[model samples]
Target: MAFFGIFALIPLVGVVYFSMVKWNGMGTPQWVGFDNWSASLTDKTTLNAIKLSLIVMVVTWGVQTPISLLLGVFMAGRQRYRAVLSVLYFLPLLFSSAAIGIIFKSMVDPNFGLFSHIPVRWLQQSYLSPTLALPTVMFVITWAFVPFHSLLYQAGVRQIPQTMYEAAMIDGASPWKQFWSITIPQLKYTIVTSSTLQLVGALTYFDLFYVMTQGGPGDATRILPLHMYITGFKSFDYGRSAVISVILAVVGLTLSLTLNKLSGTGKMESQQEGI
Candidate 1:
């Protein structure tokens, strides 16, 4: 309660308040209720940003969920080599998002990035061009975030009782059948939690894309958070930016609550044989 109030609720109220008035992030905020909302909603660039954010959300969720799930299951194996693989998988999590963005930007640059010196004609292409910017960004986002989600799944997989697998084996179940019937059913709640985090986190992805593309190849990569930053800091349109912030907050909260409710995360039932 205390942390939510301090960090989320309070800032939300402040953003709502500021959205009603015109301000360049300084001086007294002039009253202009609903005007900021209207302008921001109608702006083509802002609309494009919203579309891009949704695309990113869907693509990341689709791409990350399966890879994370599979990797998590693989990492949960007791084999020694699996332990080594787990360490390698987690290395990306050690780097800051900004650092990942910068590193990737350099690597993917058509002019001076990794491919430039490789002399591979087919591989040498502009990754940040408008035709490819969003896809490349999506790939990087998946690469950077999959490890964390996979770790969540790994923990979930381990928490499943060993007896469950033993029982499945006794029933002559194959590995694939055990995974679908046993592992998938057991990890339902973890799926909900990981999915909620992934979806909400998508809306707030700013630092990575900011550092990587700055909303270019002609704003092709401008998600909502990046748009809000440019509107507030660069364009000095704090009022409109606050409106965007409120929209993002509302959408994020809605997604989280909706996912939790639909997943029945609050209604726990035992998955084990005799729990």
Candidate 2:
């Protein structure tokens, strides 16, 4: 906690303070009060970035969570196959974002790439087209993060007593019924935790977009993190960048707390104790 306070908390406090002033990094900061906040709130690019970030978050949750839950449920019942497949699924997590971005970039390149021979050139144009860029990045982000969430769900499934399944089986519960009644409810905490992580990640997503699209085909994939980076480094508008940071922190904290409450994660320990 001490280390976290010194590193994370202190920097966040600095960011909040800096958000109220205009600074170009090398020059003296000018007190701008709420001007940066006002400008950022009304800025078209910032609004677009927020919109794209929300789209990515929705797509990620829609695509990644269900798939992870399904895979986790399937793998939980198969010990031998699970051992092999878990490694395969987790291999993506071992690679750095830059490496994965570069490899995928190559795979989608217009010439001498795997997707180059496709009739429609969908892969080549995915990051280059304004209509497709955000969705394409969302898909890539989902692919990268699914395995981690799957592992979480798998761990949750393992914690569930096998005797409950046996009891359900003897009581004539079909596999699908067991899944709906048992699996889904039992994995509630895992779902909440994974969804929170994915939401926060998608909101602040940057590296893949930086490597793959650089927030282009005209700012289609410019998430808040990328927007913050551009505002700070590229444009030298540190105040506005800090404003984006504070917004991200507040948004992330709000969503995490809301999901925790909705899923009853905060009550889990007390419920278990009562039992």
Which predicted model would earn the best TM-score? 1
What does candidate 1's lDDT look like per residue over 185-269, in tens digits? 9999889888888888898787788888899978889889989999888998888888787788789877877887899767432
Give stretches of model 1 more than 4 Å off. Answer: 1-28, 267-275
Predicted structure 1, TM vs. truth: 0.87
Worst 10 residues of 1 by lDDT: 266-275
Cα displacement (Å) at residue 221, model 1: 0.7
**Which segments of model 2 are wrong by more than 4 Å?**
1-28, 118-127, 267-275
lDDT of each: 0.85, 0.78
Model 2, residue 109: distance off in Å is 1.3
TM-score of each: 0.87, 0.84
What's the true lDDT of residue 20 in model 2? 44
Cα error, residue 27 of model 2, in Å, equals 11
